[model samples]
Target: MQFRYLGRSGLKISEITYGNWLTHGSQVENDIATQCVRAALDAGITTFDTADAYANTKAETVLGDALAGERRESLEIFTKVYFPTGPAGPNDSGLSRKHILESINGSLTRLKTDYVDLYQAHRYDFETPLEETMQAFADVVRQGKALYIGVSEWTAEQLREAHALAVDLGVQLISNQPQYSMLWRVIEPEVVPTSKELGIGQIVWSPIAQGVLTGKYAPGQPLPEGSRATDEKGGADMISRFMNDRVLTAVQELKPVASDLGLSMAQLAVAWVLQNDNVSAAIIGASKPEQVHDNAGASGVKLDADVLKRIDEALGDLPESDASQTRSPQGRPS
Candidate 1:
C-alpha cells in the first residue's frame, strides 16, 4: 500500500484505508469483522476510520476488539464525534464543550486506545460556537487524548475558520473528511480547492457513491439480497435515487474503462478519486474480507488523462447542492 501525508501534517496514512460504517457492528459479526480487519492489515492498510454514531457506538468497540493484543501499534486509528451516542438530551450531542470532552473520553474507552491518531468532528455544529469547539479540540490535543484533529462535512468557510483557529492556538487541524466520488462531485468545486489552498488533506469517504459506481444495481433490478438497500436500515431511499436509469447507464459506460484497465468497477471508482493529489486517503467500507482485499487492489490502478476525461463525460454534471439537508440515507460528505 502507498502511504501519503494526511493533509500538511507530519502524519502519513495509507492511500487505501479501512472504514467501519454500516458494516462493523451492523452487518458484520465478530468473526467477520476480525477477518475483515486482518485482511486489511495484511494488505498494508494502516488507517482505520470509525465514528461514535456508527452502529450506535458498537462499531468502535468491535474495531477496538479486533485491534487488541500486539496489533494496536501497527495501525493508525481515527474516529469522529458530534453525533448523539445516547439519549438526545442536552449535552448528548453537538460540538459543545461538554459534549466534546465527554465524547472524547467515551470514544477513547470504546476504541481501547488512550489517544486517537485523528479525532474529527463529524459535522458542523451550528448550535455551538466555533471558538468553543476549536478550543475544546485544542485542549484534547494538548492533553494527549487525540494526536490530531479534523472536521467532516464542513463548508469551505467553516474549514477555513477551524484551520485559522488551530493555527492561532498552536494546534494542528490536519485533514478534512468529505464524500467525493463519480456519482457525487459536489466537493470538487469548493471543499477540494479550499482544502488544497489551506494545506489540508482530504480523506474522502464513500468514494464509490455507496456502491452506485460499482455497476451492481442496474435499472429496474430488485435490491440484491443482503445489500444495504434490502436491509432494514435507512439506505433504501438513497438506493432508490441511485437506481435511476441515467445513473445505471453511466455506470455501465464505465464498465468498459475498468475492463480495459484490468480492474473491477469498484477499484476503478476508488482509483479515480485518489487521482487527485489533494486526496490524502480514501476510506472504504467492507462487510467481508474479500471486499477489503478487492478495495486494496485499487492502489495499483491509475486513471490517466484520457480515462479521466471519459469518466467525466460519462458522469456529466452532478448536483452541487447539499444532500444532507434532505435527509439523504447514504453517509453525507465527511
Candidate 2:
C-alpha cells in the first residue's frame, strides 16, 4: 500500500486507513471485526483509525485486541476524543481540559497502548475556550500520551484558530478528519485550502458517501437486506440521505465509467477522493473482510481526466461543494 505523510508532519500513514466506526463491538461481533482487521493487514494496510466514542468505547478495545501481536512501531493507530463516553455527565464530552486529559488515559487504557499516533478532536467544540482545548492537546503531546494532534469536521475559521494556537503551543496539529466523498464536497471550497496553507492534510472519511457510491442501492429498489441502512446498529441515518432516487440513479450512472476504468464502483469512489492532493488518507470502515480487500485496491490507482469528467457529468447537481454550507456540528459529535 502507498503511504503519505500526514500534512507536513514526519509521520507516514497508509493511503487507505482501516477504520471501525459502527461495525466493531456493535454491528459486527468481535471475531468478525478481528477478521476485517486481519484482512486490512493482509492487504498491506498499516494505518487503523477508531474513536473513543464509537460503540461507547468498545471499538477501541476490539481494534486493540485485533492488533495485539503486530509490531506497534509499524502501524499508525489513530483515535479521536469528543462526544460522550461512559455516563452522560456534563464533563463527559467536548474538548474541555478535563475531558481531553481524562479521555486520553481512558483511551490508552482501553486500547492497551501507551500512546496513539495521532489524537483528534472528533468535532469543533465551540463551547470550550480554544486556548484550553489547544493547550490540553499540547500537554497530551508533551506527556507522550499522543504523538500528534488533529480535529475533525471543524469549519475553516475554527481550523485557523486551532492551527494558530497549535503553532503557538509548539504542537503539530497534523490532520483533519472530515466527512468527504464523491458527493460530499463540502470541504473542497475552503477547508482543503485552509488546511493546506496551515500545513495540515485531510484524512477524509465516508469516501463512499456512506456506501451510496457503490451503486448497490439501486433506484426504485428496496434497501439492500442486511445493509447498513437496514441495520440499526450500523450507520443507518448517515446513509439515509443518499437513499433517494435522484442520488441513487446518478450513482448508478457511474458504473459504466468504473467498467471502462477496470474498477468497481467502490474503487472509483475511493480513487475520486484520493485525486485531491490535499487528502493524505481516506478512512474506510468495513464489516466484512472482503470489503476491506476491495477498498485496498484503490490505494495506488489513478483515474484519467476523461473518467473524472464522466464522473462529474454523472453526478451532475448532487455534489455539495459550497463552503458556506459547512457548519460546526450542532453540539453533537456524529
Candidate 3:
C-alpha cells in the first residue's frame, strides 16, 4: 500500500484507509466486519478510521476487536467527536468542552486504545464557541489521548479559524475529512486551497460517491436489493442525492474508461480521488472481505492527463462543485 503524509504533518497514513461508517456494527455482521478489517490489513493498509457516533458507538468496539492483536505502533487508528452519541442529552453532542472531553474518554475506551493517532471534530459546532472546541482539542493533545487534531466536513473559513486557534493553542491540526469523489467535487473549489494554505490534508470519505461511481446503479433499473440505495439504516439517506437517472446515466459512461485502464469501476472511482494532490487518503468501507481487496488495488494507481480528461468528459457537469455545499449542522444536536 502507498502511504502519504497527512498534510504537512510528520505522520504517514496508508493512501487507502479502511473506514467502518455504515457497515461494521449496523449493516454487516460482526464476523464480516472483522474479516473486512483483516482483509484490509492483508492488503497492507495500516490506517483504520471510525467514529464514536457510528452505530451508536458499537463500530469502534467492533473495530477494536478486529484489530485486537496487531502491534499498535504499526497502525494509525482515528475516530471523531461532535455528533449526538449516548442518550442524546442536551450536552451529548457538539464540540463543547464537556462533550469533547467526555467523548474522547469514551472513544478511547471503546477503541481499546490508550490514544488515537488523530482525533477529529466530526462536524463544525455552530453553537459552541470555536475557542472552546479548539481548546478542548488542545487539551486532548496535551493529555496524550490523541496525538493530533482534525476536523470533518468543515467549511474553508471554519478550517482557517480552527487552524489559527490550533496554532495559538500549540497543537497540530493536520487533516480534514470530507466527502470527496469524482461525482462529489465540493471540496475542490475552496476547502482544498484553504487546507493547503493551513497545512492540512484531506482524508476524503465516499470516494466512490457511496457506490454510485461503481456503475452498479444503472439508470432505468430497479434499485439493487441490499444495496446502499435500498438500505434504510441511514445509508439510503446518505446516497439518495446521487440516485437520480441523470447522475446514474452519466456514471455508466465511465465503464469503458475503466475497461481501457484495466480497472474496475470502483477502482477507477477511488483512483480518481487520489489524483488530487492535496488528498492524503481516501477512506473505503466494505461489507465483505473481497470488496476490501478489490478496492485496495486503487492504492498507488496513477491516472495520467488524458485519462483524467476522459473521466471529466464522461462525468460532464454531473459533479457537484459548489463550495456552499461544504456545510456543517445549523444548530447543536439535541
Q: Which residue pairs clash in candidate 2?
A: none
- In model 3, which residue pairs have backbone atoms overlapping below 3 Å? none
Deviating ranges (above 4 Å) for candidate 1: 318-334
| Candidate 3 TM-score to native | 0.99
Candidate 1 yields a Cα-based lDDT of: 0.85
- Per-model TM-score versus the true fold: 0.94, 0.98, 0.99
Reference-based lDDT, each prediction: 0.85, 0.91, 0.95
Candidate 3 or 1, higher lDDT: 3
Q: Cα deviation in Å at residue 36, candidate 3?
A: 0.3
Report the candidate with higher lDDT, 1 versus 2.
2
Highest TM-score: give the candidate number.
Answer: 3
lDDT of 1 by residue, 184-254 (tens): 76677777788888888989998887888888877777767887677666556555666678788778888
lDDT of 3 by residue, 1-334 (tens): 9999999999999999999999999999999999999999999999999999999999999999999999999999999998889899999999999999999999999899999999999999989999999999999999999999999999999999999999999999999999999888999989999998999999999999898989999999999888999899899999999999999998889999999999999999999999999999999999999999999999999999999999999889989899999999899876
Best by lDDT: 3
Predicted candidate 2 versus true structure: per-residue lDDT over 1-334, tens digit per residue: 9999999999999999999998998999999999999999999999999999999999999999999989999999899998899986889999899999999999998888999999999988878888999999999999999999998988899899999999899999989998899899999989999998999999999999888899999988888887888877657888887789999999989989988889888998998999999999999989899999999999999988888898899989999888877766667543
Candidate 1 residue 201 Cα shift, in angstroms, is 0.7
